[model samples]
Target: MTMKPYRSMLFVPGHKGAWADKGVNSGTDALILDLEDSVPPVEKVAARDVVAETIDRLTGQGVRPDLWVRVNPEETGLMNGDLEAVVRPGLAGLFLAKIYNETDVVRLDAVLSHIERLRGLDDGHVKLLACFETAEAMGSCEKIVAASGRMVSALGATGPNADAGRSLGIEFTLEGLETLYMRSRVNLALRQIGLIHPMAGVWQDLANLDGLRTFCEDSRRLGYRGLVAIHPSHVAVANEVYGPDPEEVATARRLIAVYNEAEAAGSSAVDFEGQHIDIAHVKTAQALVDLAEAIEAGS
Candidate 1:
């Protein structure tokens, strides 16, 4: 599946199939059907079929958002069942939950390859999106991410009392300086691997749109191009924060036009609205325009 540089991916509880419609209507860039934490112990087995049906229905209806599944980890002895149920035609990727090291990465890769072939899907048909939520995972993130060619993007996994905070034995803060080092390290690892559009977080506050907006803005400033959201309402906030807004897109187009004109006149740099722009600036502007176009084309 081609990545959309998702601005927001909302997780829908696998057992609550109806909520899937609500998520699609909420304008999220993608849907992560949860067969892990959101599902209860009693519903774990049955929820797999429900999630599979939801994927098939959405795919049949031609839903715009790419569908993903957050499968159970191997420790639970339920991951094999989860993967068997969800890795089909409609699945775009899997959120490699609770990955602790490169060993876990290789194991998951092998499992995915087996399932893909067994189901008549192409080799590497499904992609992996790593989650750095445990201390072991956090410490060896670079190795884990590089362990598989199936990795497309990763989430830094910061949250209040979530696995990340609890595993690292840290408290959460609105300013986020407490977890800044780990988050920053994840960003650096992604950069070294030549991956752009690194993502982070789950706001966890369903009612506080204002606080969620702050989290989104702060994440964008930290070089994260997207975010993991639990609620659909958070989608608009994320899209706005990580946006190549209309004005930015317009300015980029104008800058490209002006720069091209200057080059034709035998100049290397030109003043554009009090800012000196050169080829470097042009490349940045073009990237913004391209992202804007992609977001426009996606659901």
Candidate 2:
């Protein structure tokens, strides 16, 4: 599976068909048609069918952002039915909720394999976006991520009063000091395992756009590659905050140029902008530029 850059993933209630189109037009990198939280208990089955039809509609129109489904947890006994309804050609993958350990991921992978074969999709075509909303999941972050090649990214930012907060009993704050340790641990595990773009969870205060921006900026600075936004309004904020700034891109290009010139002159390092730069710095600059270029092309 090709790894797509996900700066922002907007959540659309699976039961609401109109919101899916709005979500796609909201400029998010991807859309998560949620069958778990947003849909009421009585509507879960109907929501699955709605999500399936939405996937077909979006793909038939050749939409931009990828479509993902947030399926019910395995414990619910509704996941199998959810998967059956939404695992189609246009569907990108699943956003697994309430994962506890590697065993959960392994079971999911087995199910995906069977689904792909049944649907005639390529092996591993249905990727996973794992959400660590429980204390056990956070404790076993490394194992969970390493469990499946199908996981595109692992998320550790379950909001306050949600699964993680309830399980861990951590208070939520704007500064995020309470969950800092867990977030840092998850980030480190992802980096160590080579999943560079782990997603931060949703900012629930929908009315406070400024607060949302601050939360996203903080996450970006903390090495999170993107955010999961519940509202369409937060989409642009995530994209901008996670994206390389114009000034940063220009500096990266200039740094690479200076480094190349230095190397041509029989020098492996160069004094550029009052700082000494070597091949390591050049590689970083090149990477930033490459990311910028990719984002531009995708846009």
Candidate 3:
């Protein structure tokens, strides 16, 4: 699978033009222009117009970070209009919300396929971020991912969803564990299909800095590429959680250097910091370096 570093996925309201620009400029790996929850009921149409205009402005200005739009769920009044306004050039993918099953994914695939054709783009240029928020979606996450045409870019789920075990009075410790399991399943499915890493979910609180950090760290350990950010303040935490730390980068460089030296001597592994470094360790170290560089370059 082609790796796209989405260490930070910051959500910007579609109606807020200035904030949209700020979000892109924020040190996030990706900016998700949200047309769903961040937007209100009455302002949906205006939000679409604002998002389209912002996209046009960004494209004209040659902004480079991966851009995506979180469309309202299928069957919502704004879903079709969201697609119409958000499917312009330079769009990296779509953040499909409230995906209930594979059928919904298939329908969206067809819709995106049609939209691509109408716009004279490649039939499958636009990818999807399947948001598995419902119990049905959680149960069928693997199948939903498998059925996503062109492969979905990522998978996400929320903590307060009606389907979460937390809804049954389970403590967050257990709930977080469940979330980890669900995210792991989704990640495994995406990997099996050879797709990019999946996102976890939005932490929902902007002021609870500790909560955000713990949640992001949890997601990172669960194998999620990143956590979704509802507030720009959370972007830094998300990026830090997903990207390699300075110490980690330094260690990786050292391991890589030692491994190369050993390979030059016809050895398969090298001892570094009292630990044996093999090809897998070297590859992982290089990946960490790549992720760090991508974050610095904002691409």
- What TM-score against the true fold does each predicted structure earn? 0.97, 0.97, 0.89
- Across residues 1-299, which tens digit of lDDT does each residue of candidate 3 receive? 25477777888888998897788777777778889888988998889888888888887887765788888887687788889888978787888777778888888889888999999899878877777666677788788888866665566546554335443343345247646666788888887887757787677666988888888787777777787778878888887778788998999999999999999999988789999779999999998898788767765
Clash list (residue pairs), candidate 2: none
Query: Which lDDT tens digits does candidate 2 get at residues 1-299?
Result: 33577889999999999999999889998999999989999999999889999999999998989999999999999999999899999998889899889999998899889988999999899988888888888889889988988877878856878888898888899999998888888888878877788899789888898988899888888888888999998898889998999999999999999989889999998999999999999999998998888888778
Compared with the true structure, model 2 gives a TM-score of 0.97
Off by over 4 Å in 1: none
Which candidate do you rate higher for lDDT, 2 or 3? 2
Residue-level lDDT tens digits of model 1 in 39-69: 9999999999999999999999999888999
Model 1: worst 10 consecutive residues (lDDT sum): 1-10
Model 1 TM-score, all chains together: 0.97
Each candidate: how many clashes?
0, 0, 0
* lDDT measured at residue 250 in model 2 versus the true structure, 0 to 100: 100
Question: Sort by TM-score, best first: what order?
Answer: 2, 1, 3
